[model samples]
Target: MANVLIIGAGGVGQVVAHKCAQVPEVFEKITLASRTKSKCDKIAEMLPRKIDTAQVDADHVGEMVALIEKVKPDMVINVALPYQDLHIMDACLETGVHYLDTANYEPPEEAKFEYKWQWAYHEKFEKAGLMALLGSGFDPGVTSVFTAYAKKHHFDRIKTLDILDCNAGDHGLPFATNFNPEINIREITANGRYWENGEWVTTKPMEEKRVFDFPEGIGEKDIYLLYHEELESLSKHLPEIERARFWMTFSPNYLKHLEVLQNVGMTSIEPIEFQGQEIAPIQFLKALLPDPASLGPLTKGKTCIGNIIRGSKDGQEKIYYVYNICDHQECYKEVQSQAISYTTGVPAMIGAKMMLEGKWMKPGVWNMEQMDPDPFMADLNQYGLPWQETWLDKPFR
Candidate 1:
């Protein structure tokens, strides 16, 4: 058992706290901290086991380091914003504690996000004899682990990979996002990219569309190809992959709202004068939108996300797909969160459990795929998010 500290109070953070409390054997003690102390206290109140709560600005390394020292947690699970990733990592390094986060680092002024910044800390973590796990959430987390499992058990060489993420949940509110409004809007409005033939290919936002028939009666939905951070690490870790792409399902209604917002410049990150004050249009728009955390009770439907790989095994070409389907209502019934947060949060707890058990403890920064997938796969079944596999005759592309 280990004492764990969670940083963040959003939907994902709430789910992470609840899930961690459920497994006392792995997490002997847990503390949930965030910029808002009430949010952390509220989430802690719902857990089956007692959990401590505190208020700290994750963006301030000094504050975070001080809190870490006070709590003396064995590990810190960062479910905070991408902008605070480096600060939390720095604090972890200072205190010689393990670090894990769901997303990669993205600059506050720029919408651009990449793994290079976090990957640069490999040597620092190694030197400090501490471990840092990057992208342990759903897409970059479970999806990456799915690819590694395929490579280990089914494929001799993986050449192509297509990661399909479908969120069929409806939050009742017409314009609310399933996660942080600013982060969600920025990610969708940015230029799309994919890896192919040793180079990055760019496209206009939501320009490339395809329809995928999801498994388990999830039906068909329109998916748009986008550049995700997972492609970078997957390409580097799996050299045999010649082409890699990430696609996400978007409803027509959602696209229409996004288009209107884009046309009115409401999605722009640039600051403009408003009422004699400078304000970012996108940030203003986020204020107008409903918070993702409040949608759990109203959200309904499911999310299907997984990886499809094409490779060769024993001189024979093979195609395999591994995925998980999570229902929002079911997730809410279990953990009082929608499927998006539940999907991401469950894996965060599992990864922490692996580290606490010393199954994946190492002194270096590592991606999810670098660790053994067997224990993770088993944990998926034991936990809330269960997965399934199927052999396809050909790639979805």
Candidate 2:
């Protein structure tokens, strides 16, 4: 049993709190803190076990360090914004506590996602005799683990990888992001990029489109190729990968609204002079949109995310697909969150469990794939996000 401190009180944080509470043998105590104390209190009230709540600005290293020192948690689970990753990591280092996050660091000014920033702290963590786990969320989390499992058991050489993420869930709102709005809009408006022949190929945002026949009767939907952070890490770690790409399905209505927002400059991240003050257009736009957490009750349908791997096994060509299907309504019933939060948060709790149990713990920064996938895979079945694997005659595309 361990005492864990969770930063960030968004939708993902709520799920993590609930899931952590469910496993008392692992997490004997939990502290859910955020910038807003009320949000933390709200989540604490919903959990079956007693969880402490506090207020801390995740972006401030000193604040986080003070909280860590006060709580004396064995580990810190950071579900805060991508920009705050380094700050929390620094706090963990100062306090000699293990660290884990679902997403990598992205600068507030620039819309970029990569593990380089976090990877640079390898020496710091190793010297401190602490561990930092990056990209433990669904795509970067379970998807990365899935590939590692494939390498261990299925493939001799992985040649191509297509990470298909489809969120067919409907929130019954015209324009609402499933996650954080600022992060969502910044990522969508950025360039589309993929790795091929040991080089990156860039295209216009959402330039590549295709129709994919998803598993478990989700049917065919249009998917757009975009630059996802996982591709960078996978390409680096799995050097044998010849080509890699990421695709996501977007609703027509969402696309239409995004197009209009882009045309009118509502999606711009650059600060503009407004009422004698500087404000980012996208941040202002986020204020107008529905809170992603509130959409859990209204969201319906499912999300299917997986990887289509084409490679050689036993000196013979082969293809395989591993995926997880999550229902939005079902997730809400269990955790009062949609599949988006549930998918990301469940793995986060599991990742912390892996560290606390000494299964994947080490004195350095690491990605999900760098660790063993078998134990993590087993826990997925034991937890909510159960996965399935099937052999494909050929690639889905």
Candidate 3:
């Protein structure tokens, strides 16, 4: 058994706390923290067993260090905002604890996503003999591990990869994001990018669209090309891959509302003078949107996210697709959260388990694909998010 301190009490944080509590044999002691102690308290109440709760602004490194010193956890599971990742890492280093995060670090001032910021900490973590697992969420987490599993067991080499994320659930809102509104808006409105022929290619937001006939009755949906952080690391770690890209489905209703929001400058990240106060339009908009956690009970339907790879198994061209389907209401029934948070949070817990169990432990910061995939993949089915795999007749275009 190991002690764990989880940061952030948002929707994903709730799932992480619940999932961690469920595995008492692995996570013996649990403490949940966030900016608001009440949020942490609310989540702790939903858990099956008792757990400690605290409050700390993850943006402040000193505050995080103090909290880690107080809790003295064996590892810190970061489900906080992307901007606070580095600060949490700094605190974990000072407290001599291991680290794991769902999303990578994104500068608060810029609408960009890159792994360089966290990748720079490899030397520090290596010297300290502490392991830091980055991008342990669904896309960068499971999808990357899926690739490694394929490479290990199926493929002689992987040439091309396509990651598809589809959320067919509707929360009965005219406009809302599944997670944080500010982060969600910034990501969709940004330019799209993918890797091809060992080079980076860029496109206008939602420029490339495809209709995929999903399995298990999820049916066909419009998926658009987007520059997810996983594309960068997957290409780098799996250098044999010639092309790699990430795609996510969006409803027409969502696209129209987003367009209107963009035309009116409501999605802009830059702060402007408002009634003698400087406030980012997107931040203010986040205040007006529905909190993603509240949508759990209202949402219906399921989410499908997976990877399709085309490569050579024995000098003959072949294709393989592997993915998981999660239901919103089912997740809420189990963890009081929707599928988005459940999917991301489950992987975060499993990653922590792998580190604490010495299954994927090592010094230095590493992405999901850099580790062994079999054990993590096995845990997914044993946990809440079970995956399906099959041979594809055609390649994704």
Candidate 1's residue-wise lDDT over 22-102, tens digit each? 999989999999999999999988999899999999999999999999999999999999999999999999998999999
RMSD of candidate 2 to true structure, Å: 0.7
- For candidate 3, the 10 contiguous residues with the lowest summed lDDT are 39-48
Q: lDDT tens string, model 2, 1-397?
A: 9999999999999999999999999999999999999999999999997999999998899999999999999999999999999999999999989999999999999998888999999999999999999998998899999999999999999999999999999887889999999999999999999999999999999889999988788999999999999899999999899999999999899999999999999999999999999999999999999999999999999999999999998899999999999999999999999999999999999999999999998999999999999999999999999999999886756
Write down the TM-score for model 1. Answer: 0.99
Ranking by lDDT: 3, 2, 1
After superposing candidate 2 on the true structure, give the runs of residues whose Cα lies further than 4 Å from its correct spot.
none
RMSD of each: 0.8, 0.7, 0.6
lDDT of each model, Cα atoms only? 0.94, 0.94, 0.95
Candidate 1 vs candidate 2, lDDT winner: 2
- Give the C-alpha miss distance for residue 75 in model 1, angstroms: 0.8
RMSD (Cα, Å) of candidate 3? 0.6
